[model samples]
Target chain A: MIEVKDLHFAYGSNPHDTLRGLTFHIDDGEVFGFLGPSGAGKSTTQKILIGILNRYRGTVSVNGLNLQNLNSDFYESIGVAFETPNLYTKFTALENLEFFAQFYGSGTRDPMQLLTAVGLEEDAHTRVRNFSKGMKVRLNFCRSLLNNPKLIFLDEPTAGLDPVNLRKLEALILKEKSRGSTICITTHDMHVADTLCDRVAFIVDGEIRLIDSPRELKLQHGERFLDLEYRDGTSLICTSISMDKLGTNEIFQKILYKYHIETIHSREASLEDVFVKTTGRSLQ
Target chain B: MRLLAALKQDILFQFRHGFYYVYAVLTVLYIITLRLLPETLVYPTLTIILFTDICTLGFTFIGAIVLLERGQNLTESLFVTPLRLHEYLLAKILSFLLLSFASAFFVMLGASVGGHDRMWFVYGAIFSALIYTLFGLVFAARARHVNDYFVKSLGIGLAISLPILAYLRLFDTPLFYVFPTRATLILLDVLDHDYALSEKLFSVASLFIWFLVLSGWVYQRFDKYVRHPA
Candidate 1:
């Protein structure tokens, strides 16, 4: 659905390019993520694809149209929910959606229905200024789905939501995935990247350090050790045994046979561990 | 249809923010101030009031709206949709033009019966509003906040309103003729007096050139400072 190659962008005042050379592709219906710390040019890359930042040195094509030549019609199939809620505070929630929905032709989701989907149907008539941050975030998310967009760009989509709403939002995103909508999310949140993205790109300093599926990366980076807890007389003994050649190792066999095992489990690296290890920087 | 919807929403937004109420009180103040003037002075005073109302004040008004929209980050969100920049600008222009027209009409009703060409006054109000709104749009497109808009607009406002010094005969210069504000005053003057065809054409032609120039400047600046601020 999207292709970017050798993307380089620099602010006018700054001679150094903020985005040095970014190359990536997002398949149709696939959830892709740009995992990076703040000021890592994640939003800048998204803006270029959305055609907001046009002064960039590279090829960025979205839905077969080059970002350089996209007309207003090109936005018909694309939706973006900015990190900050960009909404009219004076307008009611329903009014805000209806106002935006007018920009699209047909096939827009009903404003009230979208409100209900985000658990905000009751506050549809309330001014956005009265809404909580989570409510505004949900409303912003709902706006992204207004056109049943083929490609959706969500920046920090779950920033302000509580666990319940966060899960609900995750479910809604998965629903979008199920319906074959390609999603691009830029966030430092490892959990969001792991659960939502089909393929994740570790981007830092306007470059991609790595790109792969979360499960694959975890296995590649994990220690693959078998953690065992057993009772040795009155004391409990804990040990990590390598999974390599486990069946042939006499020590692994003896631990299971000689000692009363309290627990035995494999230790796997999480995406967070992999991210930190690969990037050599904290997500913070 | 989208333009109309945007126009309606702009007006609705301003109204909800009490702009209409502010206009109500401001329009009344204008009518009352005009009514107190002597009959001989009413037209000249109305011309001055309408000039300020439609031109200078419209400049400030447009600045306020754009600054508010920017503050709310609506400008960025707006461009993400299928709305063209020209359509968005047109909606803003039309909304403020209509407000200026309505306010002028009420002020005329409360102050004068007939001594002027009604349609000319309407045209004057709209044209002046368009010219000055575009003038303000240039500044607004670059302003970062409400105070930023107000401060920057003050200097540009004074610079553009310089033609008034020549109109009032305090400082007469042929250079003032180069300004669209000179053409704006001509349009307003046309409402109260019969002008030669050549004068009317010059007024119209000057405003046309200024409109095109200011509109282009505004579009470029808005595209730069607002759309691609990143």
Candidate 2:
């Protein structure tokens, strides 16, 4: 749904560039996560993709149209949820959505339906200035979906939300996924990136370090070992064995023959562990 | 349709926040101040002060709104939408201009009720308010500090006008003819006194031309002054 090739951007008057020859593409109907630490050009990439920042040194096309050539109609097909809550604080949640809804050619979702989608229906009439950070985040999410966009860009979608609201957001994203919307999310949260993303890209210092499905990356970098726990008379004893030699090894056979096999487990690397190993930097 | 909705929302937001009410009171008080002037004074001088005050108030409020939006990063957020920089700026200017015109109309309506010749007041108010508001936008776009714009607008307005007001005593002073106070002076010279209608027509045309030129400058450089989502 979106493609970036050799993308380069520098803040004018600044000495250094923010994005350096970055290339990536998000396919239709998939949740593509751009995982990186702070200052890794995540927001800049999203900004460029959403057509907010122009004057870049590379080509970016969304839905097959060149970025520079698209007009106001281009915005109608895409929804964007910025990392920061950028609502008009003086307006009620309903008013804010209604105001923005007028800018799109597509029919807008009912304001109540949008509020309910973000779990803010009860607070629809309250002024945004009175909302907590989580509440504002939810409202921002609702605003993004008001146009029923075919593509959605969510920047740190779950930031500042309570666990329940965070789960609600994850479910909403999945719901959008089911409805065939391409989503691109930029976040440092590996757990979210791991669970929600079908394919994830590890970006560091304006470069794509790796891009693959989480399962594939984890398997490629993980150790091949089995963890075994046997019941000792009053307790359980645990030991590790290589997966390759488990059947032919005499020690494993003896443990199985002489004691109760209490439990067995296999080990695999997590996205966070792979990220640290690849970048030599913690996600923190 | 969308642009109008956005414009209406902005105007409603202004009203909801009590700026509309505050401006209404200031506008009323200004008209009353004009009426309370000594009757011996002519109509033209009274109208000049009233219109100038109306224009100043409009400029100040519009500048404040723009500066507040800049400080809060509201403009940056709006830019992310389909809104062009020019559309936003035009909406703000037009909304303020219309509101200022309405204020001026009501003030002049009071003057009309008192049997004053308000035709000049109506024409002069529009010419003065539009010019001053456009001037205010130019400063508000580049002015980093709101207090600074406030100080600068008053300082510039007074510095330029005080000399002409002083020269009004010397009816033949060349400086009086070259300055905006000249416009006010010519109006004052004919207040209770009668002047040819041709003279009023000439000054009115001059003021209208001044307004048009200033508005043209505003429209030309408005895109450059938008600050690019900073």
Query: Candidate 2 - CAPRI tier?
Result: acceptable
Q: What is the lDDT of candidate 2?
A: 0.76
RMSD (Å) of each candidate, 1 decimal? 2.0, 4.0
The stretch of ten residues in a row with the least summed lDDT in candidate 1 chain B is: B113-122
RMSD value for candidate 2: 4.0
The residue ranges of model 1 lying beyond 4 angstroms of the native Cα positions read A230-234, A245-264, B191-194
lDDT of 2 by residue, B21-71 (tens): 886886788678767877564365455555456555766787787776666
Model 1 residue B134 distance off true place after TM-score fit, in angstroms: 0.8
Please report the TM-score between candidate 2 and the true structure. 0.84
Model 1, A155-253: lDDT tens digits are 999999999999999999999999999999999999899999999999888888899999999899888899999998999999999999999879889
lDDT of 2 at B28: 81
- Backbone collisions counted per model: 0, 1
